[model samples]
Target: MSYVNQSQTLNVTSEQKYQGLLEKVLLSTLIAMPCCVFLFINGTMLFTLRSKSVFRGTSRYILLYNLLFSDTVLLALSQFLYTLAASKIMLSYPVCGVFTMLSILTDEISPLTLVVMSLERYVAVCYPLRHATIITIRNTGVAIIVVWAFSVLNVFIRVVLLLDFPFSDLESLQMTDVCSDIDMILSPMSDIYDKAYTGFVFLSAGVAVISSYIGVMIAARSASTDKASARKARNTLLLHLVQLGLSLSSTINNPLLLAISKTVSRVVFARMQNFLYVCFFILPRCLSSLIYGLRDQTIRPILVYYLCCRLTLSPQPKLRPKIHGVN
Candidate 1:
């Protein structure tokens, strides 16, 4: 009877594993398709932006480049993870460490870039005369390099700590792509350190984004020359504010949801966690194509032109040649 009971338990466990695998495969497939499409779209946006005279030498152009680069990298990463899921490529410890390190670094770096962009906009709108003196291309490039270096250095600390983990766990040998064993990695941190670090990153990033937008809003309302300019600035400020809000809320909410899903045996919390992750990660990537790429005039024309050429039997329209005015 004891042997029979043990065999039945093993069967049940195997069934659960199979079900989880199926669920993960389905989710990854759903995530990968949209990300792949957007990756191409963002690529075109980047290309079009580079080829245009309107975007050249502007801070917006630099931001467009960074946004496209970040999104492309992120989309490629998502596709890679999904491919791994499809193949069920269980990674080794070294591969897992590298994957986790890159993911964390990139993830942190993107927000830092956004924060820098917000500050750029703030200075440009709020202090127009001072902006020319303060926020030059050289300074912007330096700031961007600093942000990348800092994020890399910070995330590298986490990577080093992960390497020095004293635990004797078999799970490290068969790591998943999602950075699954965060709790294990956090073991060395005192309660105070963990809380402090989390709060600092989350709060500091949020504050920087918000404050920049607020500065923009005030400057737009107070110093703008025309109603249209003011309105445009207001819209831009609000959009950034909304993006910051969603990102901050999602950042705080995801870990809590994940914690609940792990600690609780209820199906309800598990479903909730899945829903929240979809809302947060999946939604943001999907929206980036529309928000950052599709809205640009240069990109819109190129995309429409390409689509028309591909979809229609009609001949392509000739683009007007650039005329150089006499100096």
Candidate 2:
């Protein structure tokens, strides 16, 4: 009996140690991956910005750059919150509310920007001759500005209304050490508004993306001479669809998981929630940057060349200069 008791104790101790190690590993990954993603995205944006003549002037690259910028900001904010949570630091209600509002703004902007990008691709692929005239740099810039302004206004209004809600008394709520998804609560009216807002934005964007891709397919099917170009267009559209799915999942997954986990043990729910947060929210943001860099023909070469130059500490090869004929 003594030996058996000792063996059982030893096994329990070992399991506890393993669980502790696993949690640390996960925390480290949750912290490190977003930082790496932010760096990679900003680096690629810098590279694109440097080649202004080729990339900066194009409408597609302009939309893509904005998308990158938004995603980078989102990742940075997420990392900041993650670090604070890891350190067991609690933000005051107002500060947490600000961070939450900023995060939502960036989150909304990402998918909205993607919607514009898909529409731009649709025009480029389906209406090749008119793409340049229609999707001009100035027009694209104006559209981007509108997107930012609208996102800011929308989020600000929602936050203000939330503050005004009778049930949303920040002073009455207990403050915790970690500002996490579970800490946020929406009054009934705000909850309704949130659902409506999410549905409208996501549904509209989905419809636009789906319609644009459908148009691209129809155009590709009718074209006889540019089969290769059509295939490339289809591939790019598929990539955009994948990215869209990933972005939408971040919005949908959390609520679904919360509903399902309601009856589960608190310990299990907490672990599952954190895991899902990292998988659905953080992982998708990181992959978005990778997907864009790898899949974009124009950006791919530049990203690869920049990475190579950085790794080797060597100057990039210069492009052959255009020569003008003597008049």
Candidate 3:
């Protein structure tokens, strides 16, 4: 077999083996109430920021917009799927296929968008002078278009592949309506294609983001020009690093952990894989709100202002003191 053919075969085998695990976990992902809360907060922040001119024109605003859109869409899409499944809604063949396509698209897009945000910050901080020219509003718009276009292009393959394979084969005996036909529908070539595409997305967006922050930190070390500015830059970079680290660890390790749990005979390893996934994906999803809420200067201030405004109104001072004349 040629290299491409071998790669395709390996991916198909892996997909088939992992199909059960992915569906089981993906279905359970909908039960997360935190998803709704996070989406609401992020949506509100995006709206407020965009309403103000300061957020609309800045590069950070562009990144924030993309990030908020990505997460909100993912949560919404997940909830849709989970709700349908939970309510026992039987979807048509085409609808089921579309749901699967969208689920993957949204999930993938969230990480890819984060990658873009990271890269934007990296370029702005590391190449401060050039950032203005490189990350202009027009360019940021194009970059976002590229991210969506890429996701759509890749996800559409599912439709064609599913049409080629009948869903009847993968149906569970226990639940006939819920489709279990992911791998059977995926083209044999899907893995090679996806791996290449996912790798590009990770390196171009994810790695670039990390590298940018690293560059900024290194530059900040030697520049004694303004202590306060340098300190703030370092803190921002550190927070970005933390977010990136969490994301990268999940993207890279989750698959490997699953593969090991499958390939190895030991039951403990499989259990460990479950543990790591919760730590990586679930925990991060729940905690990212708190992380950004506290550490992100842009987001933190808005939240503080919102909270203070809520607390300071004093509720009209409760006027019950004028009844002494009647007594």
Model 1 TM-score is 0.75
Model 3 ranges with Cα > 4 A deviation: 1-30, 83-92, 166-185, 224-231, 248-289, 304-327
Tens digits of lDDT, candidate 3, 1-327: 599999999999899759756655564564456566666666666566666676788766676667656656655665565456545566666666666677567556656666666677656556767889998988888878888888887787755655665456865423346442332245666555556766776677556656766766676676643445556666665666666566555555536765776777754674564455456554554454556556666667766566354355446766777776685
lDDT ranking, best first:
2, 1, 3
Model 3 pairs in collision = none
- Compared with the true structure, all predictions reach lDDT values of 0.64, 0.76, 0.62
User: How badly does each model clash, as a count of residue pairs?
Assistant: 0, 0, 0
Question: Candidate 2 lDDT, tens digit per residue, 1-327?
Answer: 999999999999999979966886686686677677556766666566567587878887888878777777887788788777765677776678788888888888888888888888887787778888999989999999999998998887777766775546445554565775435545676677777888988889888888888888888888442667667767777777878878777777658776868788855776776677777767777776677777777777777776665465568999877779833
The TM-scores of all predictions, comma-separated, are 0.75, 0.82, 0.66
RMSD (CA, Å), candidate 2 to true, equals 6.5
Highest TM-score scorer: 2
Best of the two (2, 3) by lDDT:
2
lDDT of 1 by residue, 194-231 (tens): 35656787778778877876766666666454446556
TM-score ranking from best candidate downward? 2, 1, 3
Q: TM-score of predicted model 2? A: 0.82
